[model samples]
Target: MKDPANPTSRTPEDDRLRRRIGPTIRDVARMANVSIGTVSKALNNNGSLKAETRERVIAVANALGFRPNSLAQSLHRRHSFTVGLISNDSFGRFTMPIAEGLEACLADRQIAVFMCNATDDPERERQHVEQLLGKRVDGMVITARRADRRPGLDGALRGLPVIYVFSQSDDPEAVCLLPDDEGGARMAVEHLIGLGRQRIAHITGPERFEAVRLRRDGYRQALTAAGLAEGEGYYLSGDWSEKWGYDAAARLFAHGREPPDALFCGNDQIARGAADALRERGIAVPEDVAIVGFDNWNVMTEASRPPLTSVDLNLRALGREAGRRLIAMIDGTPMRGVSRLPCTLVIRESCGAKTDTLTGTEDYA
Candidate 1:
């Protein structure tokens, strides 16, 4: 029973008492029926306690909605608990889900991330790497898909924990996380071949990139396995742009050698461009020329006039795996330096092939 004019009293976690009755470790310890030393050890992760007791302390803290002061924790451990991320623009599109997964993964460990886009420029990449190093990030995740040579960050990255996501270094010793691009290409080409597309043509990016080389090798391997020859005129080199794909298609048409019944594009942008060029030339897709693309970017494919069939690189899984492996590395757990995730195919209207009926025997082209 209280006076009508009086307001109800509230705990520190609610109402006006929140700041006045400050929540402290000692308070938490008392509420949790634990010793001050026990609370300190549990909060700082400095001392070991019984498993049950540790869990109980954490549960009480959470129940009280206690937020750890990161500054205090950093001061106590002398660790910034921050990770650096270096990326290119393509990686920005392909690595967003992975980045989100990484953030979620690191959040469980109470770590923060600092992301920087270098736009695939060597100078900008160098500056960003240096800036992240200057901040003394605990580790770094590099997603340089187009980085040909080691940038100026190599020397600084030495002895620092690093994980390559969506890309690889020329050096085999570097820790790398990438999807099985060759296998993915094999799946895509084989799918096309199963649709009777023996005269399949490939449109890919500059041959300088490893992904390109691997994908090309897979394509060749699939053709060879099927006893089909990928003729000299069957491949075209173009940049990873829709316009480049369109221009490449025009070049193919100009050659006047038998046009391929089906085209396997390096990526979705190229596929879209090639499709547009074919439509402009009055060639019907699937009926006249079937098409396939990689990187299942829904934003690009879903809204196309005729939805494009593409391969799913599982970028989110790629990012999640990279974050998981990096965490293991930071925890001093033994880990496989290079981890390759799997890929899937997204069936759409562009490819005239049915996934369920194909056992590498059917022919539609």
Candidate 2:
């Protein structure tokens, strides 16, 4: 057979080697003087190869240090087959689910991912961005702790596909995916209203958080939509902790006015705390005051006296969509502007969804 490497000569076999599925496997097979099938069997333990032949192929592969040159391969296919994910959220609850969704899709495409957590530090974020860029990731997905934009993110990922999750991006042309906090909050409040709770109150996280304000707006909107007068202790803002929920409920009772018949909390932690306060005062949950919370953090909700009802942000779906969008962008399909995902109300005992009556025996069925 004529040599494949002969100058000024080209063959279909040679051209195939030069394509995105490149030369390493073929080179090893040729040097070992064996069929590619045999080489594959030896490497993957799939079938069988003669001892001497397998040893020779192993030595050849080891000597060559066979690893596909992604740059050269990508030049042929115009795809790096790699994506980057950057997260500023230290909590695994948010970022991990997103990562899992991204990974599940990418794996089907045989693409790899580079994941980095900035840990909410600016310097760390800068360093991680530089490293990911240096590694030539084809696209990037960023998930942040806040719903607001992050600086330098657009510039760092310029000329490459980028998706923002759980946050908005400063670049108006960038695609950002965020939960509809207002819609979620309104859903919680409306649920309490539907359950025959007239006096509804709300408690949430720090005032500085944009989510806090949106959720507050949602709570108020639901009340207005229902034509129900706002409760005496209409709103309270504090740290997003169980203690905050407890103190807020306590303060509501302390005002020497009407205690809420229902409460909508910003997050599950607050909801759990408020439930604790109600229980400590010999008040039965749902029977006395039905409660609904945001974020639907299962751990916190399940642990509550009567499991808390909360709003699910559909974070996993957000992540799956983010992955799909970035992949599309990488393939030259453009998507810009912020896309908000709606929240679903998850029913549990806290809001009296699984029971007989709000003011009767606590029949769970």
Winner by TM-score:
2
All candidates: TM-score? 0.75, 0.80
Name the candidate that leads on lDDT. 2
lDDT of 2 by residue, 227-329 (tens): 9988655788999899999999888766468788888999999999999888888888889889988887889978888988888877887888888888888
Model 2, global lDDT: 0.82
Ten consecutive residues with minimal summed lDDT in candidate 1?
356-365
Q: Model 2, clash count?
A: 0
Clash pairs for candidate 1 = 195-364, 196-364
Q: Candidate 1 local accuracy as lDDT? A: 0.78
In candidate 2, which residue pairs get closer than 3 Å at backbone N, Cα or C atoms, i.e. clash?
Answer: none
Assess the local accuracy of residue 152 in candidate 2 as a C-alpha lDDT between 0 and 100: 40
Worst 10 residues of 2 by lDDT: 356-365
